[model samples]
Target: EVKGDGRAEDAYLLATPYNRRVAERLAGAELRLDEPPPPAAATALPNIFALYEENIGAITPLIADELKDAEERYPPQWIEAAFREAVSLNKRSWRYIHSILRRWEAEGPDYEEAGRDPEADWLERRYARGKRGAGRLR
Candidate 1:
């Protein structure tokens, strides 16, 4: 059972062990909680969204945090495109997000600097499509 007085700090402390660092990162960045994309948005591409959430869930409790934090720094369209691409390539891991954010923190939250394309080799393996007799991606 979760016992808390409904304080933000208390909630942060209660985050899953794997997610504590993520929480700290978001908090340190001065993020305020905010809502995430609708469930339907994610349902269309679970692998993609799962990949996106994996990174977000690592550092922040909710999507709102990043949105709120970046509101002043990044344009909504840029964030949207970045999010969509990140989900598509499945590069939304903790490490990847950290790298992306570190650049943002240093240079500024510019989408051009944050761009990362999925590696062709990784894509071939990730889907393993049309590869007969392939037990798993190489």
Candidate 2:
């Protein structure tokens, strides 16, 4: 449900087996979307929490290399330094940089969870087609 302040929450999400699992995962993520993202995820397997945190507003800046050989390379500090250099040079695009960061950060889950169970993406994947091309489930 959308909260009074306009932030969205699951409301009564733990109702079904699948929803319960999703809710459990969201809960376990310890997400703090109200602040900036950490340099890395908390757990050894980063991005589970990192990506979730960015879903709201938290973000960590980085300069990611374009995927070559079909492989993505996210250099943790390079983006920061690049942006820092741009700012140091008085480049007036830091805001644009952040906007790009937010957009890319939002895609983190898709990158992190490629080829995993689609059911895990139910809540946000509203209107997604079912196996039989049924109507939206979430």
Candidate 3:
């Protein structure tokens, strides 16, 4: 049993009955009292776009499920407003996603289309370009 910050030197003495039980359990499990365990493995670096995509995918299904449930409880206009808010928030959340895509397009395979403006994703491009002003949406 270990105490006082669980250092190796502290393992020499068992301090309490609980400690004794822990030590006995450890012995029963056949864990060696030799050296400290190996350090945990390093975590992978995060890809912001991949994270954004994963979050978007997770939230979409959840929102869909919630909408199905919520429609019965709320008025049509209230539900519509809630749905609009959800959609607006989700659409706005893609700023980081578009930034990552733009960065990848700049550095990765598609260099030529790095900041190309297409009609479909113009909102993202506009937001990325810092076109949104104070209280514009409100």
Candidate 4:
């Protein structure tokens, strides 16, 4: 019987000895597993700047294309600075830098003026508080 979750509660009800015979005949065909096992390097590894640079170098063309129209949309210096920061901090968090770049591209002129929005502001505040608390404990 099929359940609300789309699973057959009594799957054995549909299975029979005859099903085994049919399966045996088809078993001779190469049956690749639907899902492959996880890669050997599935676990998180130490972040290395060299490895990060290699990946960034491979995607440089895409980054260049994204910045091609930046001069027309934003101040040249601000755009250059953002790109420089993104490259310099690539090893720290490329995804975060990519998100910032996307926001900058979408916001256009307002992007540079925003100056590290609420999320960054909150992080800075929290970090400052932590430092103050550590000093008090010392």
Per lDDT, the best of the predicted structures is: 1
- Each prediction's number of clashing residue pairs: 2, 2, 0, 0
Q: Provide the TM-score for each candidate, comma-separated.
A: 0.29, 0.18, 0.29, 0.27
What count of clashes does model 1 give? 2
Q: Over 4 Å off in model 2, which ranges?
A: 1-72, 94-138
lDDT score for candidate 3 against the true structure:
0.46
lDDT of 3 by residue, 66-113 (tens): 434544543443333323333444643443434434444456523235
Superposed Cα RMSD, model 4? 17.2
Locate the minimum summed-lDDT window of 10 residues in model 3.
77-86
Question: Per-residue alpha-carbon lDDT of model 1 for 69-138, expressed as tens digits?
Answer: 6545644444555555455666655445445555666777555544445455456665685456456645
Local accuracy of candidate 4 as per-residue lDDT tens digits, 1-138 = 223333323323336789776656554444334447767975543232333354454446554555454435555444444545555544334455455556766775343555645446545776776865563322
lDDT of 1: 0.51
Q: Give residue 103's lDDT in candidate 2 (0 to 100).
A: 53
Give the Cα error of residue 107 in candidate 2, in Å: 28
How well does candidate 3 score on lDDT at residue 35?
A: 56
Task: Write the number of the candidate with greater TM-score, choosing between 2 and 3.
Answer: 3
Off-target runs (Cα >4 Å) in candidate 4 are 1-55, 58-61, 87-98, 101-138
